[model samples]
Target: MNKIKLVLALVIFISFTALKTKDDDFVKRSFDAATPLYTSLLNLTGDNFKNYPHSFLPNGTVKYYQIDEWTGGFWPGSLWYIYEFTREEKWKIAALKWTNSLESNQFNDKHHDIGFMMYCSYGNALRFDNNPKYQQILVQSAKTLTKRYSPIVGSIQSWNQRKSKGDINTWEYPVIMDNMMNLELLFYASKVTKDDTYKNIAIKHAEQTMKNHLRTDYGSYHVINYDPKTGKVLHKQTLQGFSDESNWARGQAWGIYGFTTTYRETKDKRFLKTAVKMADFFLDHPNLPADGIPYWDFNVGQAGYKPDWNFDPNRFKTTPRDASAAAIASSAMLELSTFLNGKQKEKYYNAAVKMLKSLSTDQYLNTDKANPYFLLKHSTGNLPSGREIDVPLIYADYYFLEGLLRYQKLKK
Candidate 1:
């Protein structure tokens, strides 16, 4: 019996050691892959922080966007993640250069994405350096964000109205599921300033979103249009999904991530419950692929879920998988797991690990030697608009690195 027990212990020790090494290698590869890719991007962009790398064209070239674009912060946010992982001064220098370029946006209250633009960049900077200037900038951003909020709508307006050819407005007080993500800036401002005004606006926006934005199955609408004066919901539609009723994969990911952040900041059980429900809906959906990536929309091939705007029958034959959604959800799940215990925690943690593993594979990890500017591939952006149908997206890489770091910390 003693001899058998010794042999079993030796086997278990070897297995555990191998598993640890494998996990370590996986994380190392992610950072190794990112460092060169971002270095190439920096080389291409040439210290010009105003033009941010957004995505790739069909011809495999990099697409750049200006500071006013919604995706401007993700590039700097990715650099911040790389710095956090490696603690290299070079990465910090790059991150600061890109992040500081957005300082003037703190007063630009044109849209609701100020949180994404400022928080993702400056928020991560504050986490590492704890600089007082970053705090002040974030607070100013939160104040600017508040300008878009309507007391009647109880939510922030996502876009300004655009006049069509016939002089009809496109939308009235439109709020998107993506706006859920901006609440983090408000919550952080509240925490740093010891003021409840920012916190209260965030809570009210979340409450209104919960009531109006989510379907019975917890699938979120990409956009919710409300009457600016009456606060009554007028349209529950989508701008990017297969149809107004279908669950857009990235929108669901945003819901899960945002609600999880809300729960973390507020400890409100309502937000926690909503986050879990949204996560469960995404994970358990029938349309999600075996590798955990999702089709651009959950109802992509379904009979009634076809979009009227860009109805491409050929595209449905090979629907693009959105690695960005998986990355975002995996990162969110890791954080969500921390708030749970027992089997629930294990389930989410294991699911997130599986997602990270899937994303690390060569099929998704962007292994082309000829083009090394992007991290992950096969991300679908604005499918209905016929844009970036299947390509590498900056935000996909941002969240993938974030998921890797979160997983590393949880493992330790």
Candidate 2:
């Protein structure tokens, strides 16, 4: 018994040391990698740092948008992450400048992504410095976001009634799984203001999502359209996914991230289990790429009740990879790993490490300064629209940086 115990103890020590080395290497490489990008981004955003970077256009020029754009907050948020990582005054200056640009978005209640916009940027900014303005900005952003919540639907509204080329117009109120990520701002708001209203709203939204959004195997649909008056689910569909029935890779990641975050805030076991199940669906799926990234949609080319994708995973054809999804999932998985033990913990932690290692490769990371300023490559956005197929994306970089920071924090 003593001899067996000694061998097991030796194995555990070696494994832990190896993981420590890998984690340390990731933080070092990540810090080195982000420095030049920060310099480039600072110069690129010279005057109009408020303009949210969407992605690089095909011609290799950078594209920027207004605060109302969903992606507007990530640039400033990335600035905050780099600032925290490097402890440099230059990054701090740029982070403050860019974060302050979105203060007015606190009044914009047109959508539910204020969490992503304000919390991610201002939240990180507040972490480094406790500015009263940042606090007010976050509280106001949460208040504005709660305005979109309907007591009937029990979930915050995701998309406004807008006519688009896709099927986003088919519902009175549509709540996608991605909205789960927005609750972080509400949680923050509840904590700061000592108001349970914001917390209540967030919990209701999460409960509604748990009841309606997931499939039997825990994979989630993209959108759940509802009857606004009665709060009954009208139909489930997909907007950015392969088909209405298909599981979009990024959507799954968003669900897992959101639930894990919710579990973090509320300590709800249901949220934790749901998050675990979603992670399993993403990690255990046979279609998942060997490199740890995923195809745009999990059900692509596989037969289902209503299969929108016709591409096969094993006998691969031309399918786009979603690095953005992988980054998001890895970040979420790292957090989830903290909540588990034994083999389950190893599964998630190792899966996340595998993904980070893969993303650090040349195939994904953009080492060339001449190309787009975006970090990760081959991230898909609205494949049905044929827009931004296999290109660098802003949120991809944001989450990649966020994931690296998560790994670093876990080590500490």
Candidate 3:
């Protein structure tokens, strides 16, 4: 390396480390304080709840799933983050206990969320401590996930034809941008097992999504219905967003996160370029509120309805904010910022900081424990289905904590 380049690298490191001190302390202390409440929830619910502990009802009871649902892994994953942030033994115990619940998912080839279900939980454990047991579990999970991949489509199928909502023939081998987030597990499995198949699947899936899932504006759709036999795209629509053309905040975040991870795993410049483009569209979108968090769907306007960031969701039901999307994007951006430098790096880092500030405020955090169920509030789940609307979600808290930790990492 050139002498001048070495000097400039030191300068950037010092600047990021200086910022890390304050932000790192805040995230560490906040999560440390919330640990007891999370533990209490785990104890109270125990194995009594059929599904994973995902969210809470208005009455404060745990919202759970009966089986290995897509979200079953977040609770354990959050516990792992808690342990990583605090280095406490209690959290490790909690993480192990919760992660063990999903052990059966290694055989669950029914859905395309094993990465979310397994990698997020067990994957984190192996990242910190290379447990041989965890390695086998993750590799098995990765293999099961690849079963959904179709050579005809050149991508892993996200939903099964048996599970499609409409006429079974209407949607054939559909893929969603969200599947991009799961590629990390395949990449991980490849490295640990020394098998190229996992890596190839991840790369191929990314290529397909990059080709068919993105709009001209670089925003992503919720689903891309593909003709399984011929690898032809049949339909592009937004099931969660307000309209087909409307970009769902969470879907865009998923694309940003997915491609960013692709860049990290493959070190491919195209992946980094695509991730930056996704960030540009998300952060610079016209409908983005001044507060930094986004509405559930960016296009949920009254034809020409202007967005009001401060509007009370209780009063205006037309548009609710998705804190979950903001949380996911914030974490991804902090990591993305590290991969770039100059003004481009600063742009992503600043945007992540702004969103973190908004989320850490009293407006978002539940300080008084009025909701022992969750940490943040007003996270929209699925507005179209009238489910989990304008409420706290488990994935929201998981990503928020992860984002804070990422912010802490950047400063260090």
What lDDT is reached at residue 42 by model 1? 89
**Which ranges of candidate 2 are over 4 A from the true structure?**
1-23, 163-169, 305-317
Question: How much is 37 displaced in model 1, in angstroms?
Answer: 1.2
Q: Best candidate, lDDT-wise? A: 1
Which pairs clash inside model 3? 20-411, 51-65
The lDDT for every candidate, in the order shown, is 0.89, 0.86, 0.84
Between the candidate structures 2 and 3, which one is better when assessed by lDDT?
Answer: 2
Residue-wise C-alpha lDDT for candidate 2, range 1-412, written one tens digit per residue: 9999999999999999998896578666766776787688678879685577788888868877787878888988888888888898989888888888888899988888888888888999988888998899899999899899999999999988654334345667989888999999999999989999999999999999999999999988888889899988888877778777778999999999999999999998999999999999999999998999999988776766454444234543578999999999999999999999999999998999889888887778876553636777889987866678788788888998899888878867
lDDT of 2: 0.86
Between which residue pairs do clashes occur in model 2?
301-309, 301-310, 301-311
TM-score, model 3 to reference:
0.89
Q: Residues 231-348, candidate 1: write the lDDT tens digits.
A: 9997778678888888999999999999999999999999999999999999999878899988888997698775657476685558789999999999999999999999889878
lDDT by residue (98-208, candidate 3, tens digit) is: 787778889898879989999888988776777898889999999999999988899999887643433333667889888998999999999989999999999999999
What's the residue-level lDDT of 173 in candidate 3? 84
The most accurate candidate by TM-score is 1
Q: Is candidate 1 or candidate 2 better by TM-score?
A: 1
